[model samples]
Target: MSATICAFILTFSTLCGSRVVSGVLSAPTNVSLTSYNMNLVLRWGPPEGATQDLVYTTEYKTSVTNYNVGCVDIITLECDFTSLSVSMHPPIIEYGTYTGRVRAQLGSASSAWVESEQIILDRDTIIGSPRVSLLSNGAAIYVSIVDPVFVISTLRNTYAFATYSITYWNGSQKEKARHINNTQQNHVILKDLEPWTEYCVQVQINVDRNPNPGQLSETVCESTTSVEEAPWVPLMVTIFFVALAVTLVAVTVVYRKSISHFLCPKDALPQHFKENLLKPPNSTIYLDSHPPVEKWHEVQIIADTRTVEEEGPSGGSKDCLQRTA
Candidate 1:
């Protein structure tokens, strides 16, 4: 009877020790949220010195709701709760203040809940394709909002719906123009343009009625028409060529006359003077010595001697003979 009692006591003590070891091995630590979107993700490390694999689960709550969303079975340390379609629910109406919790598990056992930091989702108007332009000099750019009216209608009274300002870079300086309120046409023509230069424009939409805006739409760029060349240049060039041709013709006529005078003087001289200048002169001769006086006297006596010689020179011959004797 004593041996049987001792055997029963030893068996009970061994069973109790086994229970304690199993409980310590299944505990968990380092719980965290790896991701959050429509769905949530929870992760945790195995219990300290745990030999077997562990599972995890997550829960969430909003300010309005007190009941925790049901738990999800996570076979691995990491688990996704996206299947719950949390994102589809309107973000907590309150700007912020939502909570989440993660639990670690192994088989039937579960770890204490690990809570997450509270977060909030803010609301604002989403503007898309905001186009602006200048209608004329000092004119505001027409603003066209491509987003549906319903999306922007909510903010009509809000600062987001107010008139927009058009700002542009003009070479060295910045220029701005104001847009009319509530008009939807985006086409604007810039007048008094600098004739030939570039301009870049952007529309400023006031968000949430805040003096300091929250976000900016994409910027659009355009420029005014360039100045054109003067119309008289072609006509001026044609007149210049015509004058040049006339001058060339006058010069050619004068040059031809000068050349004829130099090369053929006879053609240029008077007709009477030309004939006389071409005729030859008559010839003339000179005697070297005169014949004796007797030759000269006989020549004179033969011709009709007019004085005593012509009457019959009787007295003249006698007188000449006495003088000779």
Candidate 2:
């Protein structure tokens, strides 16, 4: 989105042109306020030539009161009051309505103070402008919030809060702008748009607490989707399904054996082994026979003896004895 901010400058003049006389100088003219980096600046144009040295002072007020501040006394054509100090009951540098004035000064002589109308600064007013997007491939426009809300409860800014307002119009002549409001939901999609037609849209923060609305986003304009490609949708859809079916068939043809194993497998072992596995009688296999017993026999032995006797030496022979076995 493209955007431009106006730098407002206000000036006052006591003399018509560069006419020179030995007296107080003329006030500035064509004062305009411009938006810059979320701040306001004042700029103006002055007469062509100058002879005497001049100084400047400025004042601002949220309400009617004495507001005095130092404006750059240099020969510059503009002043930035956003950072300027002031002597006032309540300062205008906040988020509220303000009115300001400026005057030219010499050593002793001074020009009349020229005052401005009500100048409102909610420098914190609108968040960065909302963003516009084209959708339906260009059939519709989308509007939504792009930044957080800028709220200054210090000033009790009581306007439409928590809502977004969208305005749209056709590019053709005599078309009245249409609007829609949404609560909290910061986005909206416009449908049933005329194909190939141009449209404009803008969005703003809606404040319900007061009549004043939040600032508007930058305006966006775009052409709707074209109708020339309407017939291609169904043709593309048919091609998609046909391609999908062909891919599935090719995969199945290449991996048929793996698919069969996964879906239907056969038994790998005999059925009898499974049946007799837990039967105790059939659980063991013996390989050896029984052993024979041994018998024993007993025997006895007999002995016989015979005896003989002999006499003394002086006597005749005595009896002799002998033993036999």
The per-model lDDT (C-alpha) reads 0.49, 0.57
C-alpha lDDT of candidate 1 relative to the true structure:
0.49
Q: Write the per-residue lDDT of candidate 1 for residues 91-129, one digit (tens) a residue.
A: 333233456676656566666677765543223223333
Report the Cα lDDT for residue 211, model 1: 38
Error of 1 at 160 (Å): 7.1
Candidate 2 lDDT, 20-88, residue by residue in tens: 244555666665554332344556655344434665566665555556453646566566666554352
Candidates' RMSD to native: 28.2, 25.6
Mark the regions of model 2 whose C-alpha exceeds 4 Å error after superposition: 1-22, 29-55, 62-65, 85-97, 106-109, 118-129, 137-141, 147-164, 169-178, 181-184, 194-200, 204-325
Model 1 ranges with Cα > 4 A deviation: 1-60, 67-143, 147-166, 171-195, 209-212, 226-325
Best by lDDT: 2
- Residue 313: error of model 2 in Å? 99
Give the range of the ten consecutive residues with the poorest summed lDDT in model 2: 1-10
